[model samples]
Target chain A: MPHITIESGKLTDEQKRTLVERLTAVSSEVMKIPPEFYSITIHEIDDASYGIGGKCIDLVKQEYMEKHS
Target chain B: MPHITIESGKLTDEQKRTLVERLTAVSSEVMKIPPEFYSITIHEIDDASYGIGGKCIDLVKQEYMEKHS
Candidate 1:
C-alpha cells in the first residue's frame, strides 16, 4: 500500500487545505486511487528542529530574506 | 511493505548524506526494520515549485527569517 505523508513547517489553514486537495488530486492521477483513500499528513516542524547537513536550514532562510525581509 | 522517502528542500551534499544515514537509522529504530530494506528519497523542490495551500511556503520563509536574519 502506498500511503503518502507530507511533513512541512508551519502553514496557514488555507495552505494546509490546498495541500490536501492537491496531494489527493496528484495521488489519484498518478496512482489511480480515489482522493478519499489517500492520506496526507502535515507536520509543522519548528525552524530549529529542521536542519540540513547538520546545520540549521540556511537555504530556506536565505530565500525568505530575499522575498520577505 | 513500507518504503519511506524523505522529500526535502535543497540540501547540501553533507545534509543529504546525513539524511540518508539518519532516515535509515530512524526507520530501523521506529519500524524495527533494517536500513537496507527502507527506501529514502530526497527531492530538492525549488522555491517556486513547492507551494503550501495556494501560496508558496511563506511560513517556512518566515521561520528562516527569524533564525538567519
Candidate 2:
C-alpha cells in the first residue's frame, strides 16, 4: 500500500478531499494498486513554520505578490 | 520551507517527537538550514489502509513474522 502525506499551508476540507482523491487516483494508476488500498493525509501548517532559503514562506509570498501586483 | 511528511503505522507521542527532532536535525544539517524553520508531520495509518504488491502490509508483516519466528 502507498501512503501519501501532504504538508502545506491551510486547506479547506473540500480541497483536502479533492487532493486525496487525485493523489490516490494518480498513485494507484502509476503503482498498479487499487485505489482503496491507498492512504492519504494532509497536514495544515502555518506559513511562518515553513521556510526556504532562510526566509519564511509568508514573507516570500508577500514579496512575490508585491512584485507581481 | 521544506516540509517533511512521514506516513507509517501508529506511533506514540514520544516516537513522533523523536522522529520530528531527528528529521529536523538531519534535514537542517544536509540542507544548511535552521532546524526551527522546518516543518514535520506524521500520518499514522492503519495497516488495512496500506498495501503493496497487491497485499496489505499487515498481512505481509504477519506472514513474515510467522515464517521467521
Candidate 3:
C-alpha cells in the first residue's frame, strides 16, 4: 500500500477541497483504486526551500541581475 | 509543480536510500522533470489510522470473530 501526500502552494479552502476531489478522482482513474483507500496529506513549504530545475530561484534572480545590469 | 510525499511501513535505511534514488529516477523518466526539482518527503503512519477499501481493518477482524464464532 502506498500512502500519498501532496504539497502545493498555500491553497485556499476552496482550492484544497477542489484538489482533494480532483486528486481522488484522477488517482482512481489512473490507478484503478478506490478513493477511500488512499491516504493523502498536504503540506506547504516556505518559498525559499523549493526550487526548479536545480536552480535556487533567488540565486537565479541574482544571476539575471548581474548579467543584465 | 507538485511536491510528493511517500509513506511506507517502517523502512530500513537501505530501503530509504533506495527509494529516494528510484523515486527520483522514475519521476524523471515519467515526468521529464529533473530529479533535483522534485521535493520528496517520507512518513510512516501507525497501522490503526490506515485502512483499505472502506473497511477499517480492525473492524474487519472483529467481524471475522463474530462470524466464525
Candidate 4:
C-alpha cells in the first residue's frame, strides 16, 4: 500500500478534504489501484516551527510581506 | 529524498523532539545518510479523527478502558 503524506503549513478543513480526494483520485488513476487502498495524511506545522533556508518560516513570511507591502 | 512521516495520536512536545532525534539517529546509522539530511514530520491527529479497524480510535480506547476498569 502506498501512503501519501503532505508536510506543510496549516490547511483549512476544505483544503484537507480536497487534498485527500484529489490525491487519491489522481494516484489511483495512475497506479491502477482502488482509491480506497490509498491513505493520505497531512502534517501541518506553524510557521514559527517550520523553517526554509535555515530561516524560520514565520520570519520568511514576514520578509516577503514587507517586500510586497 | 527519503523523508519520514509519522501519523498517530497527539504527542507531547518532548515526545516529538525525542522522536525526531531518535528516528534520525537510527535511520542515519543504518542508511549511511547524515542525520541532518533526514527529514521527519509527525502528523498528530485527535482520536476522533483517526480510525482503526473501521472504528474511531476514541471509541476503541473507550471500550478498552471500560474493559480494563
Best by DockQ: 3
Write candidate 3's Cα lDDT for A1-69 as tens digits. 457676544556765665566545544444455767666676765445657678655677678999999
Collision pairs in model 4: none
**Per-residue accuracy of model 1 over B6-56 as CA lDDT, tens digit each:** 444456777666645654564355444465655556666665666655655
The best-first sequence of candidates by TM-score reads 4, 2, 3, 1
- How do the residues A5-43 of candidate 1 rate in per-residue lDDT, one tens digit apiece? 544456678766765565456445544446574555666
Question: How do the residues B1-69 of candidate 2 rate in per-residue lDDT, one tens digit apiece?
Answer: 557666666767866666566656654554456878777666777988877788888899899999999
Candidate 1: fraction of native contacts reproduced: 0.00
Over B1-69, each residue of candidate 4 has an lDDT whose tens digit, in order, gives 457767778776656666666777778789887766766666678999999889999999999999999
| Candidate 3 structure quality by residue, lDDT tens digits, B1-69 | 457787654566766666566655554444455767667777765446656577665677678999999
Runs in model 2 lying further than 4 Å from the true structure: A64-69, B1-69
Best by TM-score, which number? 4
| Model 4 Cα lDDT, one tens digit per residue, A1-69 | 789978888899999999899999999999999988999888788655443322345666888999999
Q: What is the lDDT of candidate 4?
A: 0.75
Clashing pairs in 1: A15-B53, A53-B15
Give stretches of model 1 more than 4 Å off: A58-69, B1-69
Candidates 1 and 2 compared: the better one by TM-score is 2
RMSD of each: 20.7, 10.5, 6.9, 6.8
Candidate 1 vs candidate 4: the lDDT winner is 4
Pairs that collide, model 3:
none
Give each model a TM-score.
0.43, 0.50, 0.45, 0.55
Worst ten in a row by lDDT for model 3 chain B:
B23-32
